[model samples]
Target: MRIINNKFNIKMISENFGRYKYNEVDKYIELGGFIGLKVALEKGKQHVIDELKISGLRGRGGAAFPTWQKWEGGIRELDEETFVICNADEGEPDTFKDRELIAKDPYKVIEGLTISGYMRSAKTGAIYLREEYTYMKHELETVLELSREKGYLGKNILGTGFDFDIKVFSGVGAYICGEGSALIESMEGKAGKPRLKPPRIGSKGYLQMPTQFNNVESLAVVATILKMGASEYAKYGYGDSIGTKLISICGNVNKPGVYEIPFGLTLREIIENVAGGIENNKKVKFLQLGGVSGPLAPESLLDTRYTYEDLWDLDLGIGSGAILVADEDMSVIEYIKLANNFFHHESCGKCIPCREGVHVYKKK
Candidate 1:
């Protein structure tokens, strides 16, 4: 999704979206594409991790886990066959942010994964793309090919003697595959269902090799942070949040699209200023923050800052950074019905509450 020009702070990963086309390697190079990896290499390995630690970058795929911790864990795993994976299966109902990152700045993701590969000492990287986004697969593959030819993805990258390569793994159209374990299981030719942790992704991820699996946005932002430096990149967000966030705003909004707002913006500011206010000037009654699993934020919470720490106090999350706004005319029951129907379909019959609870709501 090419960002429609708006007077908002869409920095870092999204600065080049509509300004330039990312179809060619030359365009990417001219616009400073692989500089992050170059700077990362120059900063030395430990400092690279240190910068991530200082950046306060968190996982963007709903998990809200700190990016630096994941990187540190991956680095700690001393397996030669470790791998880095990008979860490109953007299946969240209101979340389509990852697709933009993949479609527009494919090379950025490549550079991010390459940097991740170096950090984790992993020689292989994979992007688990959604089946519906097959259109972008070819474009991303083309970028990767050109990157390899230009000494970005192959052996002896930039003559650093570090070898890493990336491949796109087409998904099987299962929402559960968004889970890291399920994704790995599907990749291994098995049913895509959540597996027990303990043998976590870092220890026994893809093919039992230590893996650092990050969402597309998370890894792409890693590339951006590498270039901007921790302190400079930390300038945008609210107290302790510290970064920009790509929020996919939909439903009852006048200009519904992805808007990259700095973290900690009130829901009102985003819905009013960023999304051009609610559609038809209708008063927003409630919001579905994140996707179905996220909180049902009432209008009273519109003033609430968008942050994991703040939202968690109210039992909410920044799941994929998606906000679905509903006007006063929208029925609350209908929303529940839709949520129940979706969860009913997605329930893998793993637990009683989720398995039977959705069904009960559907019957109501």
Candidate 2:
């Protein structure tokens, strides 16, 4: 639990805010929020990627792919116009970690993306935020504007000449838009739909340019890895599953809040300590680890470590950091019905899989 001793040196946003309150504009500036950009500019691109690669940071957006590898491939394969997209379209029903990052510390996300842009030599970055969370999108935009005005987001950022800028492109309210390829299509002002592999997005992505797509949490960790060496970061969790995770604990919990805990933290610990246990004095029956697409984990696996590799054994995943603790009263069938309804309504009706799939679910 105590990751940092004498927290001033702790570069991560969550670590710095243990007892500190979010009060003034000066509070963030003093806490090394955008300092990563300055460091990246001085140190250069390869140094940034090497640090993340050593940190063993995996993607927090369900798939848990290596973050450094994604950046490296995008940089090496693509030209200067290579893009970085933060998939803030958190359409997962109960997941709100992305929203929390956008609301509480938008600067951290921006800082991380700025580092990536500098390293990849990217001209543009996009934060594809969900339209449902209008307030979060607005707040993120305000923070971005403030950073830009302060010379953190615009040309000659921190006097490094590593030019990068980020824009918030609100999606037209579709859950599937969270997918990397679907996001690219949406950004291109077309209907959001997944593109086929063979020419994967990393090689040819985002308006036909190689793009590195990361969830908000994954990018936020990049901010810390830049400050703390990767070896030190790897000490936190399992092999290939290093660094902490930001999970949104909701549904039937006495307290529902997003907590950034180490990777191996148990499900029980999350439900009892972080989420303040079950609601209405009810007993927890089961847990839905990811969002709807994620497989359900029974009570027997409560002691399991919340990691990508561990979840993979059960054919489940920590998709989108959505930890829904279902009480005995919650109906599984009803929940499925609701999720199906969402899919049905949001389907663009373009592809056979989505269109016919939605139709079948709608009829059900």
Top model by lDDT, which number?
1
Model 1, position 206: C-alpha lDDT score: 87
Candidate 1: Cα lDDT at 49: 79
Error of 2 at 341 (Å): 2.2
Q: Which lDDT tens digits does candidate 2 get at residues 1-364?
A: 2233321122243655443233334567777666666777788778878888778777888787777787777667644468888888888788887877777777778888888787677888999888787667667777778878888887988776767889989887888798888888988998888887868887788878878888888888888777666777766655567767777888899988787777766788778867888888888777997787677777788988777777888787888889888898988889878878877877767678776553433554
With candidate 1 superimposed using the best TM-score fit, by how many Å does residue 151's alpha carbon deviate from the native?
A: 0.9
Best by the TM-score measure:
1
Candidate 1 contains a number of clashing pairs equal to: 0
TM-scores for candidates 1 onward, in order:
0.94, 0.88
Model 2 alpha-carbon drift over 4 Å, by segment = 1-13, 16-25, 78-80, 196-198, 238-240, 356-364
User: Candidate 2 — which pairs collide?
Assistant: none
Give the least accurate 10-residue stretch of model 1, judged by summed lDDT. Answer: 1-10
Superposed by TM-score, candidate 2 places the C-alpha of residue 264 at a distance from the truth, in angstroms, of 1.5
Candidate 1 lDDT, tens digit per residue, 211-285? 888888888898898887887877677777777888899999998887778777778988998989987788999
| Model 2 error, position 39 (Å) | 2.4
